[model samples]
Target: MSNGDEEGVLRVLVVITRGERGGAQVHVRDLLVGLQGRAALHLAVGEEGFLADEARTIGVPVHPIPALQREVAPRRDAAATRALLALARRIRPHLVHTHSTKAGLLGRLVARRLHLPAIHTAHSWSFSDGISWRRKAFAIPLEAAAGRWTDRFIAVSAADREVGLRYRVADDARVVVVHNGVADTSLRARPDRPGVPVLVMVARLAAPKDPLLLLQALEQVRAPCRLRLVGDGPDRGAVEDAVARLGIEDRVELLGTRRDIDAILADAQVGVLVSRQEGFPLVVLEAMRAGLPVVASDVGGVSEAVEHERTGLLVPRGDGEALRAALERLSADPGLRAAMGRAGRSAYEARFTVQRMVEGTAEVYADVARRHGLPALRRPQTPGRP
Candidate 1:
């Protein structure tokens, strides 16, 4: 590797297909932030994604690969793979780590061909229910084949680890579970409330997120409540249309793309997430850290993050009636909300901080390097090598 004289000062190249404003994207960026000053970091990202802008702002050297899109075009895939291989040849990185599906496949294929150690972290498995069976069947063999090229497999949740085992990507020894973490941003405490129940939902306005169902549940709530939707996406207009159709537009406010999320949570009574599935959402942790009572759908990694009645309430996914009941129960009982919020914050402090995540990932990097025959970490010895 071109990084140094094999003294464990590794060079790492992070390749991602699309770094959009999503949970996985945020987690990868934060991982990079933690690795700063520890390794020589380089990025190869989609030419036009939110991540490129964010990565640039963070002062990482990013190469724009335009063909690395989320779509499945054979020509584009080949081109992006070629670009990645060429960059790997030039960068001579000791370690290549890729996040998300598209990048994981193409980047590892290239990294292995170039005789480099590689790690792939699946924020969530791409092939799951709701997607077509044809896609799932195809993904199985593709991921298994890709697994041969990967050295360490990182799953963001235990459920995802099960999926990896089923797909034959991880047998046991090769797999490690790394929970996602967020920056220790100081969240302003929720201000004293005096009016109607305020419910805050933060998610991309996508179909999977099912923001419309939230509106439906809001309509069913017997108590008066105001809904705040934070995030912008292609589905924004549809969500707005749903609000208008329900004639609850006045009670619902769409606040798109605000960096002042802590302040938003500060003003709300309860924080909610209703995604069809999740891979350990950072927003849930943020809400918990902000000390807002949570009412989220019971899906994927959400149950792992929320403690049901103790830290939050989890209703059956897609059940508007149960969702309405949970919201109303928490809304009517301030004591219950306060108690759950306190527990959630305590959970945040115990498990999910930037420091803990950095240490875990750094240890993983050291392990991967040692397995690949890289030199052990050097101490400023009273002479030199052992």
Candidate 2:
């Protein structure tokens, strides 16, 4: 249990479903960097993938549990719980912190049974109004059930917190709002390109993302411009179909999973997100960091990410006409885009930073460890004085 120096240190365990290089995974990875050497960090991951390799490169211990499934399956859930329980017994961690829905539910359930303090971060709600009624009903109860097992529920946005309370999942006392933070140094403004405007949308091409909405809205746009869709997902085909059907395929570029997101943001004049719902999107933060104005749908914690007419514009969720108008306004007025982009960069610096995020998460770990009577204190990993 003691992975630190002679001095007593905290032994913290952070559990996650998968450690892929996505928004949630990247956030946790950054937090771990700040916690390294300060705590005995053990990452319990589900099935090996991109995250497993990344964690190992950082010298963090990783435990793989394949039983964790994205879908709701009684048999798999039970097996995942058993696997988690066994891992907990062996690690005997002072605090158990989990991210994502599947890992959060199963990890907290096992932690509660073992009489350990547990915390979960709701990166985004899986039960947004955008999904089918059947899916929402199933997710609400499951999420509500898991809330009872968690000692604290960390939400990335006030909207998500409101949803939790509305559904009777977690009370105000147990819920904490920790806005998503990204390093402000990452922002780089792109030089203006002559001719048509360039609008960018970065997100996993999943169902909830609704990239097709942007494509449809493009038909209504009067200004000449190109829409760059970044990120990959199962819904790529649907998006392509919509673009082709709308005869805007030439204007739409499907740039799947590009490494130059910052570069792309710098060259772009505007950023857009038409998701059914969002939980403080990191892409928006990245866009702000790049000093690119945003035009996102009003859903979930999206309002928190974008300030109407100031940092960026907010359109009604799924409203194509409003979206088209917003894009046109930005495209037509270069001055307006520059002003909004400047405001967005300022917001990013004031509210979002990797250091702030790591510090907040560390505080949570310390609190959970104290409540559960786990070992506290880890040697500082800074180069000068270990």
lDDT of each: 0.80, 0.81
Residue 235 local lDDT, model 2: 92
Candidate 1 lDDT over 95-171, as tens digits, reads 89998889999999998888888899887777644455788888878888889988898877787888788767768
Least lDDT summed over 10 consecutive residues: which range in candidate 2? 377-386
- Which lDDT value does model 2 have at 75? 96
1-386: candidate 2 lDDT, tens digit per residue: 22444235566668888655678877777767667767777888886866777667777888888888777788988998898899889877767888988888888888788877888998887775566888787788888888888888888888888888888888989888888887555447752446788999988888678888888888889888889998888898888888889998778899998877878888888988888877888889889888888999998888987999998899998898999899889888888888898898888888887666766776667676777676765643552100
Error of 1 at 300 (Å): 1.3
**lDDT for 18 (candidate 2):** 68
Residue pair clashes in candidate 2: 9-376, 9-377, 9-378, 10-377, 19-51, 187-289, 190-266
